[model samples]
Target: MTRGNQREKAREKNLKKQQQNKKGNKNDGLSNLQRKEKDAEIMRQKQAAAAAKKK
Candidate 1:
């Protein structure tokens, strides 16, 4: 019975760690995507300004 209980505890600990890691990855990915989108928007704005200046 002790061994079984120990195994269950270990499994739960590992599962929790895995879930935390996945959450971290998802958060990182979302932030990177947002940064890229903002950068693209800035580039587009700069290009438009340049075109306006040329005309």
Candidate 2:
């Protein structure tokens, strides 16, 4: 029983480590160009909405 508990704990620890590694590479999920294009598109939409509201 104790050995089973230890294995479970180790598995949980390994899962947590993997999740942390994935979290740390958040920026790598998008290419630089893609990220910039996404940001620009978001900004463009926001500005257009604001302009429409002003009119």
Instruction: Highest TM-score: give the candidate number.
Output: 2
Alpha-carbon runs more than 4 Å astray in model 1:
26-55
lDDT of each: 0.88, 0.92
Q: How do the residues 1-45 of candidate 1 rate in per-residue lDDT, one tens digit apiece? A: 899999999999999999998887634545777978887899999
Q: Which ten residues in a row are the worst by lDDT in model 1?
A: 24-33
lDDT of 2 by residue, 9-28 (tens): 99999999999998887456
TM-score for candidate 2, residues paired by index: 0.51
Model 2 lDDT-worst window of ten: 21-30
- Model 1 residue 55 CA deviation in Å: 39
Instruction: Give me the runs in candidate 2 sitting further than 4 Å from their true place.
Output: 1-28
